[model samples]
Target: MVATTAPPPVERVAPQPPWAAGLSDVTASDASLRRFLHGLPGVDQVGAEARATMLATRSIKTVAKAWAIDLAITMIDLTTLEGQDTPGKVRALCAKAMRPDPSDPTVPRVAAVCVYPDMVPMAVQTLSGSGVRVASVATAFPSGRASLAVKLADTRDAVTAGADEIDMVIDRGAFLSGRYMQVHEEIVAVREACGNAHLKVILETGELVTYDNARRASWLAMLAGGDFIKTSTGKISPAATLPVTLVMLEAVRDFRDTTGRQVGVKPAGGIRTAKDAIKHLVLVNETAGDDWLDPDWFRIGASSLLNDLLMQRTKMATGRYSGPDYFTLD
Candidate 1:
């Protein structure tokens, strides 16, 4: 792992917004930050896992299933973040986001298309006026091992390229080392660099190792100005598991109750099939309540989830099981 110096503590130089009411009230001292984070509710691992398992068994049929499929389509952050990503691929992803299914204009488009910083312009150009926003994963995504300056610049570049949202990875090393203040400062800096774009802080929970750490990371990100707290970068194993997501959901639910600020949650990676998608919805409805069921408060970061949803929707409509050839190769 790469070593880098932690940035200085973030001072409340900028005025806090109305939504930042509770978070801004907390002192920036390391001791205070640690006290607040560690003092939050502890996760009952067995209870959480059992709840997730029970929720996954929820059954929906006919119209409700169809509605869920459509809702899932709208919440997708259709993503393609790869070293081999090109302009053509971005444009294709944009196209898929816009229409999703060519034969069905009635299908609602996805929430946004997620890509790397360099591809932001191509995505912006292609998605312009389509009502589909462009989201870029920045701040040395997946690893987030770069210096603070590099990470902020990476975020700024994507915003300058017209990205509507920024998904940034937190330095797991800092979090694991108990540098709560440092991790908080990094998120605040990236949130500032984002300008008007929404900031989705990627906790990369797979690397965090424990439910307690994931809960702590979720609160840390939200308190530091994350509009959304995402589970993974979709680049690691054990990404976006039901139990892990349940922990994040509980965190958001508790945060909203105390802060009146509703931060979104995105469970990226390992989510496929209509059944899996609907189960997530069930989890959302049951845990976070109906308010979080909207796309504004929840998202699924996936590359192939849209195709599966399309196939299921087609199946529901035509009463026929359509093969993979039916949908676009996004």
Candidate 2:
């Protein structure tokens, strides 16, 4: 084991980790960063898929299932990102975020309400006193095919609008073409642009096409000072899956072990069912242990998943499941 050094308290600074001890110069240049990222242990594709599949099958029923349901509820990033989004829609989403199931006071608020930069102010305003955070997807979200200037401006606008969190997509074009340093620099710049808001770096793993690339991207994001590394933008097919999330959970677990800076993991996109959310919680608990189980270290990005969680929560509390009509759609 390389003798790793300690990082300054993350509360005070955006920690740009020095790789690990002897590998301090890993991010010094393009070539070193590439070599270090590529040199890290390769993933066993079959084993990873099999392990994730096996873990997903583990069941949590009744009382234990209820606990997982609430935990998953609190981890949601209730999102509404669309070209047709209106201020009223954002306001409604914010209301749902603050009090997901209005009938159930025991139900916990979600982690945030994710929207476009233009909608941040409305979300922030509605969620002002509520513990629910306002997260705006910036840096040309869904498709990060914009210039650094544009991306930085997008991040700045969201933060200025009182967004508590910023979700930025990495340039898949740069990353796929072997420009690792460019991706790292962009995340660092966005993190700086985020000011005090937490930065979630979206990897868009579907484009990467492999588990090894996902692991590399996770490390790259953490090194570049992202508070959280996300799985996808939720606009594409094959959005957050168990195996992909398992690999990311492993990356964060290993990262904290080496750098002593605990970055978070979020699996966004396509996870709409309560069962899917619970599977992810099982994966986190079994792989990353209980620490990543909180809302701070883990997040599930979805708009419709909240309603399903509410339905399940109602079923657990009452003898029968609540009708889908009982919950307001997001």
Which candidate number would show the highest TM-score if scored against the true structure? 2
User: Candidate 1: where is the Cα deviation over 4 Å?
Assistant: 1-25
lDDT of 2: 0.89
72-188 per-residue lDDT for model 1 (tens digits)? 999999999889998999999999999999999999999999999999999999999999989999999889989999999999999999999999999999999999889999998
- Evaluate model 1: give its TM-score: 0.92
The window of 10 residues in a row where model 2 has the poorest summed lDDT is: 1-10
Global lDDT of each candidate:
0.88, 0.89
Q: Which residue pairs in candidate 2 collide?
A: none
> Which digits, one per residue and each the tens of the lDDT, describe model 2 over residues 170-289?
998899899999999999899999989999999999999999999999999999999999999988889999999999998998788777789999999999999999999988877776
